[model samples]
Target: MFQIGRIIMPSPLLRRLLAALVLVTLALPSAAAADCYVHYKAKRTNPYGLHYGIIRVSGGCPSSPGGLVQSRISSGGWTILNVVKVTTSSPSSSERRSAGSHYYR
Candidate 1:
């Protein structure tokens, strides 16, 4: 028997279930923060071109991934136009194919 605040938990099975639930709850955040996918559009002047691609971002997705996307593409002289979507899952095979050479593995 265990007393947690004003509640009495008398069953070992209940205690085990509660412990497992707590463990899962604690782990959810880290799992969610593990990886983020950013889909964006970018452009380059001079030669004049546009690109749509997806990139995997570590350290989780930010409220605004534009800056991060910009920095990642800017090295190639591409300027970020907009962040189309930010998600926790990887892009589908079709999405990846559409990105062509611009997709980051």
Candidate 2:
């Protein structure tokens, strides 16, 4: 039998496999925990104003970025032009503030 931390395994082979599984499981979260940011363009009616902004995606998934962008932006009556790009990096705080309240929330 072999012991790893608090977990015990009955055989050496089982211990190695268990250790591998544990390592993989532990690594999954950091991979999944990555945050994605979407930079986009949008427009509002009436006076017809246009703006560019960046938003942090919650789920960090493929569909989540576009959905989040549309839901957040359109709720304020802005029509989405396009999602320029999705990235794991965020702009500086000052840059976000420059986009104003209507941008990233």
Candidate 3:
């Protein structure tokens, strides 16, 4: 047991465990932020189609990773709507259900 200011504290082992937990929690954000998942809306002209999908962006991010998104979507002849969101995590297949085959396959 210990006392800090006027507050009583737990045993030294408990304090060390708490300190380790705090350090791990503090480190989580950087681990989570290490990857980039870009989500965007895109369209096609002739047949008139729209889609929302995700892509993994290499390097950091862009004001518009339009070129990155465009390259992937372009294979299907779709034009981009600029990156709507850049995230640190990728969407799970279950979460991508709405996007169907257009997902980050």
Best by lDDT: 1
Ranking by lDDT: 1, 3, 2
- Write the residue-wise lDDT of candidate 3 on 1-105 in tens digits: 888999998998998999999999998877655757788889999899888888776555665677878888888889997677777667877658866777773
lDDT of 1 at 87: 91
Whole-model Cα lDDT of every candidate shown, in order: 0.88, 0.77, 0.78
Q: All candidates: CA RMSD in angstroms? A: 4.6, 5.0, 7.0
Which should have the higher TM-score, number 1 or number 3? 1
Instruction: Name the better of 1 and 2 by lDDT.
Output: 1
Residue-pair clashes per candidate: 0, 0, 0
The pairs that clash in candidate 2 are: none
**Window of ten residues with lowest summed lDDT in model 2:** 57-66
List, residue by residue over 1-105, the lDDT tens digit for candidate 2. 877898875897887999999999999988787877788788999778998888876546466466778888777788878878787777767757766765455
* Highest-TM-score candidate: 1
- Stretches > 4 Å off in candidate 2: 1-21, 92-98
Residue 33 lDDT in candidate 1: 73
Error of 3 at 38 (Å): 0.6
Residue 79, model 2: lDDT of: 81
TM-score of each: 0.78, 0.65, 0.57
